[model samples]
Target: MNNNLPEKQPPEKTDWLLFPQEISRDDIEKEIKKTPIAIQKILNYYLLTDFESKYEEIHLFLKHFNENKKIPIAKINNPVIYKIIKTARSIQRQIHKLMGLLRFREIEGGYLYASFTSDFNIIGPLSLHFSRRFPEEKLIIHDTKRRKALFVEKGKLYEVVSLNTLPSDTDEESFFRQLWQRYHQNISITERENKKLQRQNIPLKFQHWLTEFKGSCALPQLDGNRENI
Candidate 1:
C-alpha cells in the first residue's frame, strides 16, 4: 500500500480577512450589487486591477459598506475613498505614460518586444492600447519590476509570468534605433536643454529602456524563474 499527500492549494483572499473571518465572495458580490450601476462599473473596472494595495483597500471598502450600504461620494473629504481613487489614477497615469514612451524593437522573429518597469501594474491596460494600434502584429510588453508580461497576437491578448528569453534585434531595428538616436541628438540644442523639465517628464528610472536615452534598443534581462499566475 502506498500513501501520497494531496497537493497544497494557495490561500484565497477571503481566507486572509482578519476582522470578519466568515466573510466570503458571495457576501461581497451581494454588497456590490446593491451599489448604483455607475458606481459598480467604476469599482469593477478600475479598482480590480493588479494593484498591490488593492486587497487592503477592497477589504476596507467592503467592511465600511457592510456597516453602511453606501459608496462614499465625497472622495476628497473621505481618506479611504481618496486613497482608492489616488491608487487607480496612479495606475491610469502609468498606462498613459507607457503607451506614449514605450519603444518596441522588432526582433529576429518579426515580433515586437518592449520591456519596462512600472511602479504600478499597468500591463493589462497597456495591452489593450497596443493591440488596437498594431492589430496584426505579435507584441510582448514585459513589466520587469513585476516579472509579468502581456502578450498580444492577432488582436488577442494573454499574460505570461516571465518570457523565455528575448531574441536579439533585427538589422532593420538596429538601423532605425541608430537613426533615431542621431535624430534625437541633432534636435537637441544645448542652450535650450532643460534638465528639470526632462526629469519631470521622463523620470530617470525609465530612461534605461528608452531607445533615445540609451542610444540603442536594448532588452533587459528577466529575473529568476517565476510561476504563472
Candidate 2:
C-alpha cells in the first residue's frame, strides 16, 4: 500500500463569538425598555433568577433577542427559549415560597428582621409584597447567601450589601418564639405527618429558616455579642 496521509479536516465553526463587553446598569435598563411588555417582564424576572451559568444563559438569550427582535417562541424546541422559561419558573417559585415561608422577628428598634438565604435574588421582589402588607413597620429582609439586605423604612425601600451583622433580638421576641414553637407542636397530627409531602411543599432548603421548623427559632440571634442599636 502507498503511504498516504489523510487530509486534515477544517476546524468546526461556532455560531457564537466570545467577545466580552462592559455593560452598565443604565444601558441594560434602557435595552430592556425597548422590548415588548411581555418580553420586558421576562427580562426583569431573569435579573432576579439565580443560577451558576446565568451569565452564559443571558448572553445566549441576548444574542437570539438581538437577531430576532423578539424570542422565537414558534420554535418551542429552541434551547434558549427553554432555558429562559425554566429560569423564570424557578424564580417565580422561590418568590412564592418566600412570601409564605419568610419569618420576621421584632428586634430592639421596633424593626422586623428576617434572615434567609434564597436560591434566587428575591429580596427586591419580596420588598413590594411586604411593604404593602406591613406598610408602617420598618422591615429588614436579609439575604445571608449574598450578604445583602433590603431595608423597608418609612414607606421607602432600598438595598445594602456586605452587611452580615444583625442586632440582638428583644426579650419579647424570645418569649413569642417559645409560644410559637409550642403552638406549632400542639397543632401537629402525628398520623398525618407526611415528610415527603412536607419536603415537596416547603423544601428542606427553606425549612432551615422557617419559624415553624424545629431549630429555627434560635436563628437570627445576634452574632458575636453585637449590641442592639
- What tens-digit string does per-residue lDDT give for candidate 1 at 15-46? 24445444455665676678777546545545
Best by lDDT: 2
Inter-residue clash pairs, candidate 2: none
lDDT of 1: 0.72
lDDT of each: 0.72, 0.76
| Residue 156 displacement (Å), model 2 | 0.6
Say what the RMSD of model 2 is: 6.8
Evaluate residue 60 in candidate 1 and report its C-alpha lDDT on the 0 to 100 scale.
63
Question: Which ranges in model 1 have alpha carbons more than 4 Å from their true place?
Answer: 1-53, 62-72, 75-77, 216-229
Q: TM-score winner among the candidates?
A: 2
Could you list the CA RMSD of all candidates, in the order they appear?
Answer: 12.4, 6.8
- Backbone clashes in model 1, listed as residue pairs: none
**Residue 122 displacement (Å), model 2:** 1.5
